[model samples]
Target: MPKVDAETIVHSIAAETNTPEETVARIYADALDTYRADARVLDYVPLFAARKVRATLRQNSAKPH
Candidate 1:
């Protein structure tokens, strides 16, 4: 796959999860070190999209639908 650095991953994840940019930056670095991997993929970036999406949907649903 394509090479992905911590910074790129950070911005993407932050936008997707609505997390703090700085925290996302740190989390990206930590995840890289935690997994000891060389490259990251969009399919698995930050690995928290599903939960975030779920939470968002729940909140939206709580209002109406």
Candidate 2:
């Protein structure tokens, strides 16, 4: 797993989802905590949910022709 940094994660999520960094930061906070992988890597469904959010957004953005 990639090490999660507040700035890096926020930037990445924003870039990937075309969302604001602040929103991603909030999502991170609601999803995890100080350091996303700080100590709860295998005890929650947040990580999956975050990825799902991004994936869904990406899918929605992709036009079907």
TM-score each candidate. Answer: 0.48, 0.50
lDDT of 2 by residue, 1-65 (tens): 65445577668878878888887777666655443556555544455646755765577669686
| Candidate models: Cα lDDT each | 0.55, 0.65
Q: lDDT: which candidate is best?
A: 2
Which stretches in model 1 have alpha-carbon errors above 4 Å?
37-65
lDDT per residue, candidate 1, 1-37, as tens digits? 5544556656766677667788656545555455445
lDDT of 1 at 60: 55
Error of 1 at 25 (Å): 1.1
Clashing pairs in 2: none
